[model samples]
Target: MAKIFSSSLGGSLFKDERFLYQEFVPERLPFRDEEISELVFCLKPASEGKRPTNVFVFGKPGTGKTVSLKFVLSELEEFSDRAKCLYINCFEYSSKQSIISKITNFLGYAVPSRGISYAELFSKFVAVLRTKKVLPVIVFDEAEQLLKSEETKSLLYDLARLPEQQKLSIGLAFISNDNFFLSQIDDRIRSSLQCSSIPFESYSPSELKEILRERAKYAFNEFALDEDVVPLCAAHAAKLGGDARIAIDVLLKAGRLASREGAKKVLVKHVRASFTQEKPVKVEVTSNLSEQERSILDLLKKKKSQDSGAIYDTLKDKFAERTLRAALAELEEKKLIVSEKEIKGRGFTRIVKLAGS
Candidate 1:
């Protein structure tokens, strides 16, 4: 094993930091102070015993919608002894039954195995809340998925009406990356919700740089990271829609890669390699490429042309039991090969060529 060393010069920058870099998101959200204040006002004591507000929050991914909601709920919980706050990520618990089960579990109630509809479970949930004299505050994360499901939509409808039936103070918060959620909602349900909507926009380059700087202090030792890294990472993420998560991911990966190479500080090469490695790929297509397509493409240079089926059959001997047809289709989809179909003796055969060719 190779010995690792920290750069003497970089070691002095981030000493004795206790706060988490990515975690401990500030109570006052960065660049979202106004939205935080508005949410806080809606959850204030005057609104406690009254019917709680239905809130719809929309933003692109990494805009702090979930974190801001959690922050507001934490504050509400601290002040109100009579209210209950529950957070659910609808993407994970998408169905009504699963979401209700989670709610029951959160309340410390035994989740029944069967024989309970969403309505029944909700009624039971309200009964439990009434017995405890606690108002319910529900936050649904990834709520766009819920809006797409009829069962979830019905569940939301019932939740909105809970206050009318049981006099329970119910606040429903829906967090979504998709702005189309509002338009997809049924007219009657939409009318009943009367949800106050809030939109979270992507962070600007300066904002992303500030966030990355804050994260670096907690995630790395003082002076472990290069000064240029934060700005570069921010610029890269800005090109891809200003995703904070991607910026953090890039920073973290670059640090790890540097550490692996026994380097004292992360370099631009490390960041570039990390960014390239994280490119998304279709798993099935990548895993099952036809040997012919792979071989022919490997041999050809950019703008090179080749016969499709003939090349495919030549490679077939090397990969017995592999389907050439499927490989050609996959290659075409990937734009690695371009095929032209022409009539042969019995049927049409595609004349394949390299994409650039």
Candidate 2:
């Protein structure tokens, strides 16, 4: 009994932080009031049993494309009972059969384990909707992946053509990571979709700061995040293409690092440590010399100084019999190594050495 009580107490003490890293996304969609108003108008009872608007929402990752479409759908559902809404992440269901099966499953239909093709599944889905007299709004998230696959793209084309062909009211929302997703499609497929395109842009530093601040309030107690930490995180994220996901990841990592160290509040030191620890391999390679580059530098240290051609030949002989010329140029560009132009017998030879050496 005592051991059970101790285990329960330990579990309670290690509770997860309640703060949300992503803010209330519904409020941050840039210049989307016109789009929101149009969607709301489409959900009116007068438009019941009629088709909802077909929308194509595209943007770079972490630009709130999925969140905005989801926000609008949630609001529309609340405002009207005539509309039925479903959202599917296409990354999980990249194939046509898988997507159709998920749709049927979401609508409370029993998905057959096998022997059901995508076309048959879609037919049942449309039949159920027509019989129920409900205008169904289906959203495909990460839709660029679907557009890239021929079978999935053909399924979407057929679905979009349904209303015109069978006189059934069905609306589609395609959420992609870029505008080029549409351009990559067949013209006939593109024309059949004929959607009103909505563009989502990456957040600015100030915008990202505001978003982080709002999220911090929910994720941590007041005064937990230092004033400078939010701005620093925002700047870091802005430098990496204004990725909100990265901003939130940095915030979470910093906060956890602070907590693990038993600090009263998050600080720049903790943020820096977390950034360094979680840094990607490519970024780390640029930050710290990779194993191969370190080996090259060690070899360079053996010689007083060497020209590019000589270094390349030496590395090819010593290492994997591969040239080191490209690595030399990159290191020179990074200022990790220095290059000198010296007059040889004829043309100038560029000698390379460690930056300080």
Candidate 3:
């Protein structure tokens, strides 16, 4: 009876919602200028007919690691034809053969799907690279998965040794959430890579606000968002891990909630409601913390607020005061705790407490 396919909703909140999507790469990434410059430095050599320095980019999830590299890769392609950029997710192509086959296909060389030996496939891939005279800059996203298998570990070695073995210019970029992944890799592979490491720090609350505001300008129409909505979303995601994805996703959900109710604007209530739907993401953030960080949070749970000096005194036997201070700084960065300076008699010290207290 009702028009099944047609909706009667009016006053939509979104103008173009794709800006909030993970797959959508914005032309300019806010708060990632340093990381972008470093990526360009590593990949720039390819444009000059020299082998690009291998780079390992590590950071927490949704900290703009993958997106920054993707943006750089796109710019590099536009600037020069000498660099052949190929992006691969190691979770999908975790084997040596599969990855090599992918590179071959990416270079416009097709091989028989079956009945071809890996050595033959690889030889063909190398020949194509030599003939094309383009430096292959292969980005392996989620590269931590590749280290789990001996098969894939060997693939790293082969790629690293390609210059010496095949006399071809090749570049490798690895993206991972685990900061210690390079330490787990083989020494020879590590030595050959001469890898430049770039670390992406979690966004601070203010930085997250800037990011959300920029995205909102593109995603929502004029006056569609309440003033408080971006702050609430940023604070929530900052508390978790300063995950930009969480902040953007909450904004998108809140906009949809407003549209579903035929509301004229997305308000703070919609953002709060969206928070209830992201408990799983909160658990994931908690589970991914280091044991030391978790221990600090557990200690903080017993008190409403504790002096930073006293906290160091309590955990001094297990950790040095410097290490404890660093842990507290990290916790504060994640918005897991808040720290403030206080005067203690003749001197000032920091007072620490769980966030939102």
Please name the candidate that would achieve the greatest TM-score relative to the true structure. 3
Q: Which regions of candidate 3 fall more than 4 Å away from where they truly are? A: 8-10, 280-357
Residue pair clashes in candidate 1: 13-222, 13-223, 14-222
Native-referenced Cα lDDT, model 1: 0.72
lDDT order, best first, reads 3, 1, 2
TM-score for each of the candidates: 0.71, 0.71, 0.79
Q: Residues 60-126, candidate 2, lDDT per residue (tens digit)?
A: 5666666677788787677677777888888787888887777767667778969977668888877
| Candidate 2 wrong stretches, greater than 4 Å | 1-47, 280-357
What is the lDDT of every predicted structure here? Answer: 0.72, 0.70, 0.86
Query: After best superposition, candidate 3 residue 54: deviation in angstroms?
Result: 1.0
Please provide the root mean square deviation of candidate 2 (C-alpha atoms, Å): 10.6
lDDT of prediction 2: 0.70
TM match of model 1 to true structure: 0.71
- Please give the distance, in angstroms, between residue 282's alpha carbon in candidate 1 and its true position after superposition: 6.3
lDDT of 3 at 161: 90
Candidate achieving the largest lDDT? 3
Q: What is the C-alpha local distance difference test score of candidate 3?
A: 0.86
Q: Which prediction has more favorable TM-score, 1 or 2?
A: 1
